[model samples]
Target: MARPSLREKIIESGVRTLHERGYAGAGVREITSDAGVPQGCFTNHFRSKEAFAATILDRYHERTQAIMDGTLRDKGRPPVERLRAYFDAITERLEAAGWRYGCLVGNMSLEVPEQSEVLRTHLVEVCRALTDAFAEAVRAGQDAGEIRGDLDAGDVATFLLAAWEGAMMRMKVDRSPQPIEQFKRVIFASILAPGVKAGSPQ
Candidate 1:
């Protein structure tokens, strides 16, 4: 087999380091070492740490899009169900990871947005993509009359994304699922039809 592409190696290593150590804590040497690539290879692949981090964010956005594409493309499911299922997928992933690693996008937003413009630029792109995907789902639900039509889908999408990120952070800090459960309750109240209660016995 061909040697793995340098770009792929760098991005994979960058994401792994960022996930395990957070942005500020992960160094180029550490990432390259973990990837089993020489330190010189990192410089050859990326102009700087921020550049590599941007590429890492882009790779994450691609992976996230792929996961969501699979979830949202379930043709037999209703829009509301699909939307809920999308959140369910995220919850399952966090639970599986033991909530040790929250979203890379969210984690980077906290760690590097102030330190690196390149990182912040990539984050802005990620937020845009997430908001666009969310708005599409919200629009679908609105068309189906499952979500309130009075809301701006784009704005609601932004809010929900922010809320989800916050819930993930809270879950990580608290080491409990209560934050996510509370978030789900708020989501149900905000997005679902009237008279629908939410969360499991909370």
Candidate 2:
């Protein structure tokens, strides 16, 4: 097999750099050193750090979407259970990372959206794709009487995704798993429970 190109190697290093230190902190010199490439090699591959980070975000989203599909689209599990499995999978990864790197998409959303329109557009697109997957799972749950029917599945999914980002942020801040537990508890027991009125008594 052919060896990876210097550019590919730089991106491979950039993925770890971006994941570990975030966009702004991932300097070209650091990434090149991680890749064992000269600092000038980075300029040969990426126009700017934003461009390189965008590629890293693309790679991160691809892996994230695959994980989501594995759980959210599993037909053997009940629809609501599938949602639980998805969250569990994410929690395990976050815990393994010691609650750092909350999420590349969510991380970039907080850090880069204000500075670069191109990168911001990429973040928005990735977020929409993730939201669609959750919405599909919620719709399936509603059909199976596992999730509340009155709430619009799309809206519910949006809220769930939004809340999840917040929970991940808190998890990073507190360096604890309790936020994840609370998110699952409140979501399953109340928000997504069948026939439960949102923000009101059942």
Candidate 3:
């Protein structure tokens, strides 16, 4: 097999490093060392730490898109139900990780928002992509007559994204899954429209 490209290696190492230690804590030397590549190779692939961080955000975006696609593309399921099921899976993930680390996008937002304009831009895009996906699902549910049309899908999507990130932040601080549970309750009771019930797939 052909050798794994240097860029791929760097990105892989970069993500692992960031996952273990937040952006401010991870360094080029640590990532390159883990990748078994020279530190200078990172510069060949990225201009600076901020640039490398952007690549990590891109990878995160692609991965999150895959998760959303897998969850929402279940044609047999109702749109609102599918969205809730996706959140259920997220809750499980948060608990399984001991609530130590939350969404990478959220973490970056808190850590690097003021330090790096590039990272802030990428983080904003991540939030937009997530909200857009949820908004699309909500729109479909409305057309299906399963979701109420009284609410604005776009604004609701933004609200859900913001609420989720806030919940994850609390989970990280509390080191408990209670915040995740609280989020689920609020999401189902308030955010999903008057009649729509949010829940995990059985």
Candidate 4:
């Protein structure tokens, strides 16, 4: 089999490094070393660390989009079940990683938005794409009468992304799946439940 190109190696290493370490913690030297390439290769390929990070973020989002395509966008399953399967897939991956690395996008959202406009802009686009994917599934559920119709689909999708990211932060801090589990429980039981809507009294 052919070996990966230097650029692919750099991006592969950068994704892992940036996910494990925050944007500020992942240095060029570390990334190159992880890729088993010369440190100078980084500057040769990327304009700057910020630019490299933006590329890595894109790579990470591609993987996320693949998961979404497989589960969230699976028309074979009911929309609510597709949503559950999507999160279940993510949970399985997090458990496999021992819950150390939360998510590259979530990590970068906290660290890079304030400093790097290139990265911040890319993050915004990535987030919007994710929200749209979620919203698509949510709108389908509402149309099928499986999710509450009174609330706006876009709003629910935004809330799901925001709350899930927050739960991920707590999961990383606590190094447990409890936060994520709680998120799924509350979300499936109330927010996404086929009932009177989230804030309404039972």
Best by TM-score: 4
TM-score of every candidate relative to the true structure: 0.91, 0.91, 0.89, 0.94
Best by the lDDT measure? 4
User: Which segments of candidate 1 are over 4 A away from where they belong?
Assistant: 1-3, 73-75, 195-202
Better of 1 and 4 by lDDT: 4
- Candidate 2 residues lying further than 4 Å off, grouped into runs, are 195-202
RMSD of each: 3.2, 3.7, 2.4, 3.4
Candidate 2 C-alpha lDDT tens digits along 76-184: 7778877888999999999999987687778789999889999999988988998999999889888877787889989988998899999999989998999989998
Task: State the C-alpha lDDT per candidate.
Answer: 0.82, 0.84, 0.82, 0.88
lDDT of 1 by residue, 1-202 (tens): 9988977887887887888798778988799888888899988878988888888888888888887887654556666766777888888888998878889999988888789887788899899989888888778777866777788989889998999999999999998888998998778788765543332111
State the local distance difference test value for candidate 2: 0.84
Lowest lDDT 10-residue stretch of candidate 3: 193-202
Error of 2 at 119 (Å): 0.9
What is the C-alpha lDDT profile of model 4 across 1-202, one tens digit per residue? 9989899999999999989888888788889999999999998899999888889888999999999999999998888888888999999999998877888899899987789888889999999999999999989888777787788999999999999999988999999999999999899776554453332222
Candidate 3 segments whose C-alpha is farther than 4 A from its true place: 193-196, 199-202
Ranking by lDDT: 4, 2, 3, 1
Which 10-residue window of candidate 1 scores lowest in summed lDDT? 193-202
> Each candidate: how many clashes?
0, 0, 0, 0
